[model samples]
Target: MASKIDPILEYDFCVAFLSNKWHTPPSNLKDFVVTSIQQTKSNATNMVSIISNFLKNKSFDPYVKDCLRTCFDLYSDSVSALDNAVVAFKNKDFDTASTKVSVSLDSPVACQGLFNDKKGENKSPLTKENRAYFQFSVIPFVFIQMCRIHN
Candidate 1:
């Protein structure tokens, strides 16, 4: 989906170069990649807001509540890590940026695991979307770091 792909399109070239799973991107690619990192930053900020709102308004069983709390913490941590990564990038500290981005990637896995551990099914819609958002959030930085390696 273009919506899914748009956030990380700028780094697509780096991904192709690193993975050996290369393919030529379509024309008008620049327009697609034209979305700046600021948009991802905004998305991450919005994630934090959404999670906080959900946590504040929702009530559930204690275990499920705990799980939600954990997810909230992870999302917050990811937002911080992503912000730090951006700062590192601006400072030309690519290694530090990469490390921060790598750390942020773990939030989704942990959050998803929290859901599965609670039950086989019936994951909350908010958590599902948040997990996907967390995954999407890290992708651009991944490409940016990879591009740094190549260049």
Candidate 2:
């Protein structure tokens, strides 16, 4: 179904958060959204700020900054190092996969392709490079964080 809100402003899982119901993973349309967030390993607290900023903090017009902070924080243990390891494992390139991540900016794909070009390994640098993660998490959370921000 076409959404009443623009894809830019409209959260990916707008219907689910709007309805305030359990997001039955893999079945609910919101599942895709939750899946995306889970896959990204976004920081819980920073992410909530972006979500709340959109849903509650209608001032300062905080947009992507909130999301970027969340993206960079790796307390969840799903950082680029882990990603490269997983990708290498899948491709059988454990040698490169085992390398510790220390990225800068413009090499997110490096999470899978280890070329010793430690760039884009972390979201913090990229966030400063380009305020995109804000849109990444904030927009999506608008549909998921219907409960409350933890921190």
Candidate 3:
């Protein structure tokens, strides 16, 4: 019979991966995880705020405005979901944290989907602005996967 993989080892690997991705040395494992999740949440919130402030002051075509507004709402939802995930994780409710993080991933996808037409051409102004969000979004998914591995 094959030996079962230890969850603590898996969790350590996950934390190391996140720390490397963030280009920061690992400190306390749980603290690192919680702080990294919080940073991702802050990023999502800040991006939404910036876009919303722009939309509020500028004049764009009605269609464009609607698209921007949709992106704003999606980003906001992502932030909220991430917040919930972090809270759940802190509470040691890994299942709830995983679910919330998984849900949060959809927001960015839906936000990006707004840029596509039936033919799937991507031309939304938000694309360039929001690109960084997509990059960082993967970390949360990784965190969720790590939790699964730990479980």
The candidate maximizing lDDT is: 3
Clashing pairs in 3: none
TM-score of each: 0.64, 0.26, 0.72
Candidate 2 Cα lDDT to native: 0.36
Better of 2 and 3 by TM-score: 3
Tell me the spans in candidate 1 whose CA falls farther than 4 Å from its real position. Answer: 1-37
Among all windows of ten consecutive residues in candidate 2, which has the lowest summed lDDT? 103-112
Candidate 3 lDDT over 1-151, as tens digits, reads 0012322224443455455655555465555557667777888888788778868856666666777788888888878888888888889887887677666566666777787766778757677556556555556556555655666
TM-score of 1: 0.64
The C-alpha stretches of model 3 lying farther than 4 A from their native spots are: 1-26, 57-59, 118-120
Question: Candidate 1 — what's its lDDT?
Answer: 0.58
RMSD of 3: 6.4
Worst 10 residues of 3 by lDDT: 1-10
Give the per-residue lDDT of model 1 (tens digit) for 32-146: 1212233455566676677677677656656566777887787777767777776776676777876776666666667667766434774553665655565465555545545
lDDT scores in order: 0.58, 0.36, 0.67
Q: Best candidate per TM-score, number?
A: 3
Per-residue C-alpha lDDT of model 2 across residues 92-111, encoded as one tens digit per residue:
44334323222211223322
